[model samples]
Target chain A: MADRNEILGAAQGAFNADPAASMAAVAEAAGISRATLHRHFDSREALLVELGTRSLDQWAGRLDEVDAEALAASGDAPAIRAALETLVLGYVDDADGFGFALTDHVILANADLEERTQVLADREAVLFAAAQRVGVLRPDLPPRWFGHAIYGLLVSGREAVRIGDVARRDVGRLVLSSLLTGIAQPQNQDSTP
Target chain B: MADRNEILGAAQGAFNADPAASMAAVAEAAGISRATLHRHFDSREALLVELGTRSLDQWAGRLDEVDAEALAASGDAPAIRAALETLVLGYVDDADGFGFALTDHVILANADLEERTQVLADREAVLFAAAQRVGVLRPDLPPRWFGHAIYGLLVSGREAVRIGDVARRDVGRLVLSSLLTGIAQPQNQDSTP
Candidate 1:
């Protein structure tokens, strides 16, 4: 059991470092013989499933860091923006593993994994609710739809970084701004004035 | 040459239909032998490169459909949004093939392919310039940044549809809304009621 835990942890680190790293490399990095790695994982798909579970656990834990109360108490726009920034930056830093996990989760369509990801969706709903209470988010758009939009932007931001079209640091801000004000300038209103 | 074109076209079609479909399946669909497919593509990698080129061609053709003069006349916001919707929907319909192409492109990082994709960047620039002229887009953000955001949203929307979280039909609207107005709601005007 301890060996399995060690192997899983090592695999997670390697995935976090490089999503495309070879299995043999992971075994080596984990300080396990290739044969042992195979014995434990049996196949790349098996290893990925195990690794994805661990990554999901980590993602869930990170959500705890988002202070929902503070966000609720403070300005809705800034707070939601901060929350998004935190989430995107956290994912960016651990993109190697997170990216791989997300890809595998999508490909596998594992129900349990999908259920776990709902944690994010739930968090987003909470944020949207808060935003709506403040009259920042359009009431016409459902919270679920807003959550979907947020997820879409995050996914898009990550891809932009991968394609070298946008720097990793700027992804959060760019995505945030695009969601808030949209492309059209406020025609009649001058909030600052 | 005609046979080769037929095989390539078939492969592209199969890829668009299902990303995981094997090259052998594509060959079969084309009514050709696996050996003939192998002779034409050499490998999956080669087949993907050809597909990527074709996808780029298709994307360019879609951009050409955008009425730049009309867009410039009717306020940049509406024109650019309409054009983006058209472009994103085109990719959504061909999600499987484009997703495979994107994954392979990232894994291989082919400089030649990268060079070809620049045409997309140039096309996006024209759209961004129009948005700027109409004063809808934030002048602070670079046109390239806007392009990346749009591209990212399109990719994410495809992934979202694949995961069954968001409907495929609504992806264009979600992406468009996020691009125009960010997550935050607009604040009250200081100068007017």
Candidate 2:
């Protein structure tokens, strides 16, 4: 079998560029022959299966990078914005692997995905709750809803970048702005601005 | 093949309740034999292919329901909020079918899907631009970003509902609040409330 890191790097490159890229192309990218690629991954689906598992593993680790208590201890608006920026950047970097893993039935159908996602959400919910308690988050909104909204923007911005609607670099602000304040320009009466 | 409507209704019901529902379960829900279901859809893949196509077609029609000109001419905030609610509810009702269509390769891979999405986005972009022109939508945000954000929330909220992370009824406020103003509550000065 080929080196896991080599194959994954190549496969991720292919997937990031074009999620539909053939396995043979991935092999070539990895400096391996098609036969070697097949030896490592019996089929395209198999490659994606590995990609899904690894992607989640990496993603699970990424969530821990955000220090929730520090964020909560800090000012609500700036802290929440910074926290979401961290999340958005992390998601943007791994958009391809995530686009594949988060969307496909093979990835979504995994028995642990729901639990794993909950674990992540549960962590973020603490931040949202703390932000709300400080009166930074809207009182009418649920604490967990902020997490979902940021996540929505992440995936949506990723899809936009994938379809060439916007450049990858451009989506960071777009996602954050939409998540933090919204699209509406504040009126003179609006204070946050 | 079985009746298209009967099969679609049952398939959506099954998928909404349990996205991983087997074809046999879908057939049973439709009051059809497994053999009949197989005749109608040679495989689950085939069913998703059909679902993807139909979902986009339905989604395309829903975009026209919002009237930008009328909204712009009237009061901005509440009207815009009301209009968005209409779209959100329509989407929530069909969230399951959409969860499958919008995310899957079959739907995304369709050459027409991208064009169809752009056309819908183009329509909503007009509303965003007009709303900004009316001083409701944000000035710094690109007009098209509004469409992306709303579309993002729609799909994200749909997926959350599919997974039972939050009740479907709860999503309307969650989405609108985040999209219109943001998740953060105003502290001392903001008066939109």
Candidate 3:
């Protein structure tokens, strides 16, 4: 049973690296026979679903590592900045896995997956609320909008990196700056207060 | 020759509507025989390249239609706003075609095909320069960065619409608002100034 689980993990890694990786190739990489692979996963879809669930679990675990107490002590903008940096670096390091998860999530059209996403979204909302308390994030922009904006940047930044148009470091800086300062003209920057 | 061009246009429309549409399916939709389709283009890639070239031409034509006199009379921001709306609408309406072109361009690594992108980029640079002159866009944010931001928003907004998370109208509004106002809190809005 443990051996089968290990094989599945290896297969998942191979699939993440190359979506077009054939089952036979994965079996070869795992040093398992085609028969064994078939026995483990009845079909491609079944294998993908298992991989997706595992990937989501890993992402959730990373979120758990974020120290809420430490973040609270540092203040919102800085904490959010740190979190965003962690996200970009993590995604860059495990791009293939993350990309596979993103592409699969899109292809599956599984509204149910939002249950998993909600965990991340809820964490983001908490972060945004903290930023608002610190008067760093715009109080006027709804937290939901802020959360969505962050997600949008992540998706776009990933694509930019993939296309080689933007460097990874630049993406991080751009996202952080845009989220904190905005792009409005300096003259229009006056506050109501 | 004219008839062949018409058939090619029809094929482009059909393929844009459905990427998985077979050659036979495209022929039926184009009101042409399978023989005629094969006679015009030997394969899917050839047909797509022709269509992509046409799409690029159509895009250039739209930019030409951007009435320079009217733009100058209306002033920069409004003119840019009009031009951008036109471009964004065109891309949105034929996202599949543009998407196909994007993917094909990447696969073939066709420099000539990518050169077409520069035409649009040049136009964007003009708009950014105009915004700078009018003091609407922040001087600190490089024009290239501003252009890339708008491009990123367009791509992100399209995906958001695809995912059904944001309405099409709202996507446009959000892109425009984010470009014009940015995401920064009001108190920090002019802190850079």
Candidate 4:
């Protein structure tokens, strides 16, 4: 129990580095015997579920730090935009550290996690609706689609960083700008170098 | 040898349906014995590489259909935007079909496939550069980041369709719009409901 958090952290690192990592590999990475790993997590599925839950918890914690409830009700576009930027920056690190947990098929398929994720999505819906109301986010699409788009962008941003296409320091800004305005140049903005 | 394509198709479906699926599961999905699967690919990694290669071939074929080179050299903003829309729509189907091949860790780690992927990416860079030059795409980021963003958007669009968040018919437009203009409400666009 005492080493559980350490084990999960090591396991997450191993999984992110190689999604195909096996239980034996995870045990080795966690500096434990297979017996001990099994003792902590009866199966790979169990471990994945725990990891997924932890990732969600961390995500929820981040949202709380931004006072998501207050932001959802604020109707203050500038404040909401600033909070959104902060959230995107914070999520970049989460995307890097908890990539597998957030995207794993097993975690996605798990009913409990799916329900919990939906709850988070619902919370985000409130925030997005508030943003839309305040003109911070686009109103043409459903609020839920915003959540889906961010998920894709974050993963994409992380991949860009990993592949050396975008600098790590620049990814958060790239993702936020892409989310808020997109990649198309405005008509008024001159293209001159 | 004759059943090879059929086997790969089955394996692709199985993997997309469950990334954690075992070789036995893949063989079962392919309607073949484990021994036959091994005889065909020798290992799971080999099968993934073959799938990834086939997906790249299909992607290349799609790009050819659009006359990518001509578009890259055309420097026509409207034409480039239309071509980009067509490409995004085509890729949504590919994302739905060849998803695992596109994002599988084994395929991503394979040296040969990475080289092929880079080649495809370079081709995309040319198109993006032309778009930027023509003021179709924003000139603020590298052309390669555009490719990364689209990859993320396509995957996200597919997931939206799969999870019933966005309809199949709407995913293409949603992805294109998100990529081009982003999700933020246009400043001049009326938000009145």
Candidate 5:
């Protein structure tokens, strides 16, 4: 059982790095024999199914901790940053789980997963709307669109970390800065605010 | 030869829509016999190789048209917007070619591609630096990081379009708005400058 959890973590990391990662690679990553891995799981999908089960549980807990409404009500950039950080942390923990959402995986097709995802999306919408009303979120950005962009970065930032494009610690800053401040300098800030 | 080009376009479209798309599906997309597709390219890799070659040529031409130096010197947001639009246009035309960049493929491993990608990145950095120095881009951003986000959006926006998450026409606006203004409302407009 101890080895099982370890193998799952290693598989999550390997699959997150490359969807096409092989069973041999997962076994190698887990520091276990291929036969031992075979004893635990029949195929990649079986491993993924188990991982998916854990993923849904973990994701649900993370979403519960978000306190999105409170953050939105605060309407401070730092508060939203905290919320975004929470989102990023989820990626750091189990990016492979998030990757499943991006793909046509059976995990996404799960009824429970679908409802949870919608719940999360709906919460994000409420938060963004509140923040926008308070003037922290950009007015031009549609709430749904903002949600997707955040979702995109959440998935991509993991790939960046896996490929050594960005350091693990830098993921938060990179995503938040890009999401909120954007790359274009504000006219007000360039000269005088 | 013309039929070959047409088949390639169809394959790109099909693959962009679903990377796991089958040969039969691709043939239907091309409006040709399965034999025709097979006659032109022995395998998906062979087709991808030819597409990769064409992709490199097309990408190089698009980057050249960006006139990064000119846009930077102008220090105009709209000019930068135009350059960004040029990028989005290419993705709309051949998303599968760009998708090759996102995934690990022989196309990415090719030396010519490696060099071309470097060239494009270098040009983009130069443009971004000038824009930041001129106060058109966010000063806090590292120019290269900004370029990657823009590039990421270019590839992902196409995926979004193919998945029907966004309309084909919305790709340009979504990428530009997200890159330029971000999701946060400008402080100047929100309350006081």
Candidate 6:
């Protein structure tokens, strides 16, 4: 029998290819029987809830690894930006695994997932607030807007990479620069043509 | 009898509310029988194709109204920026009606819609290239990246409005400014804090 993590991986791949894939199909993809799949997860909704929980957990782990809370509390613009960079790059690197959960309607609408997402957002708000206080971020926009903007940029970056419009390796800089400076080339920052 | 446009509008609304909504449900929503709906659209796919075509047509119309081509051809930074502003603001204003068609998988996968999307992209590329020439847009990123970025921003902005995180009237400025200047407050353009 496949381990729970292995089963979840198979299910994620199955759903990534087809959003409406059934639990039986996911079990087949994992080289297991439907009964076995049910033994692991009672229903498709249960499976989705598990995936959502795992994804949020992974996100929280990343924040902890980067010491994001301490960095944000430090009230240093450069430190906050560095932590933001780590988070963005980590997400871009794991975009394939994390993308589905981040946008999945089932995951998003799940009450538990919604609460977990709010927790992640609140943590991010600390970093954004620090950046704003230190003059690294725009004060005009609400702190929550950064959360939405980062979400948008990551989704856009993933699509661009998938379409071959942008190389995967360069997504980090492209996303970070776009987030920080917008797309327009500023006169003061101008270096070359 | 509901006109074709009326049926299309109803279908758009139905699909917006429920992406997997059945044709029978759509007909009921339109206050017409299934037979009447079939007389206008042979199948759900046909209805979706028509909606996709209409959405692309609406997008093209916005570009034409803004004279995007002429503005791009002028190769003047401010004029090109003005045209880009118009396009972004127009889409933001119509985000509720147009959002579904833009992101629907069925529409995106259709060859006909793909071709129309390419035509629109090519037209927009001219504007992007011109902006790059005058240093309005970043020359480092591919012109195509802007298209993906705008799509992401609009989707994010729509969700923000739907969740009440952002006011409907504010989406235009939020998206436009984020596109033009990004979220960071540069020292060169810093105003009152």
What CA root-mean-square deviation does each model show from the true structure?
A: 5.5, 4.2, 7.0, 2.5, 4.4, 2.9
Give candidate 1 regions above 4 Å deviation: A1-20, A25-33, A36-40, A67-97, A104-111, A118-123, A126-134, A163-165, A183-193, B1-18, B24-40, B67-108, B126-130, B189-193
lDDT of 1 at B101: 59
Q: How many residue pairs clash in each candidate at the backbone level?
A: 14, 5, 0, 1, 6, 0
lDDT of 2 by residue, B69-164 (tens): 566556476676567667766776666455655565655666666677677777667767766665667777777677778777877787667656
- The Cα error of candidate 6 at residue B110, in Å, is 3.0
Segments of candidate 2 deviating more than 4 angstroms: A17-35, A42-46, A69-81, A187-193, B15-49, B67-81, B187-193
- The positional error of residue A96 in candidate 1, measured at the CA in angstroms, is 6.7
- The prediction achieving the highest lDDT against the true structure is 4
Tens-digit lDDT track of model 6 for B1-193? 8998899889989987766678999999999999999999999989988888888888899889978888888877777777888888887766678776655667766888888888998898888888898887889888988988887788778777766778888888888888778887685645323
Candidate 5 Cα misplacement greater than 4 A, ranges: A33-35, A49-58, A69-85, A88-119, A159-165, A191-193, B31-36, B69-115, B159-165, B188-193
- Supply candidate 4's per-residue lDDT for A115: 94
DockQ leader: 4
What Cα-based lDDT does every candidate model obtain? 0.65, 0.71, 0.60, 0.85, 0.67, 0.81
Residues A1-193, candidate 4, lDDT per residue (tens digit)?
A: 4399999998999998887689999999988899999989999999989999998998898889999889888787778888888887888888888976656778888999999999988888899899888887887887889888989898899789878999988888888888878888886777634
Could you give candidate 4's per-residue lDDT for residues B11-130 as a string of tens digits?
988998887678999999988999999999999888988988888998898789888899989777778888988888888878888876656778888999999899999888899898
Q: Worst lDDT window (10 residues) for model 4 chain A?
A: A184-193
lDDT tens digits, residue span A84-165, model 6: 8888788777666766565565676687788878889888888888888888788889787888888888788877776678
Write model 3 residue lDDT over B159-185, tens digit each, in one string: 556546567666666655655565655
Which prediction has more favorable lDDT, 1 or 6?
6
TM-score, model 1, chain B versus true chain B: 0.74
Tens digit per residue, CA lDDT, model 5, A1-193: 3388889988887766656677999998898888899999998768877777677666666656877777777767667756766765665455535454354344544566566666766777788777667666776655666666776666556556644557777776787778766776665554322
Give the per-residue lDDT of model 2 (tens digit) for A142-192.
676776777677778877777677777788777866776776666655522
- What is the fnat value (0 to 1) for candidate 6? 0.61
Score every model by TM-score. Answer: 0.72, 0.82, 0.61, 0.91, 0.78, 0.88
Instruction: Provide per-model DockQ scores.
Output: 0.38, 0.45, 0.25, 0.62, 0.41, 0.53
Model 6 CA deviation exceeding 4 Å by range: A20-28, A33-45, A188-193, B20-25, B33-45, B187-193
Which 10 residues in a row give candidate 3 chain A its minimum summed lDDT?
A102-111
> Who wins the TM-score comparison?
4
Tens digit of per-residue lDDT, candidate 1, span B81-161: 666667656655555456655544232356677776776777667677666666655666767776666655566666566
Model 3: per-residue Cα lDDT at residue B22: 77
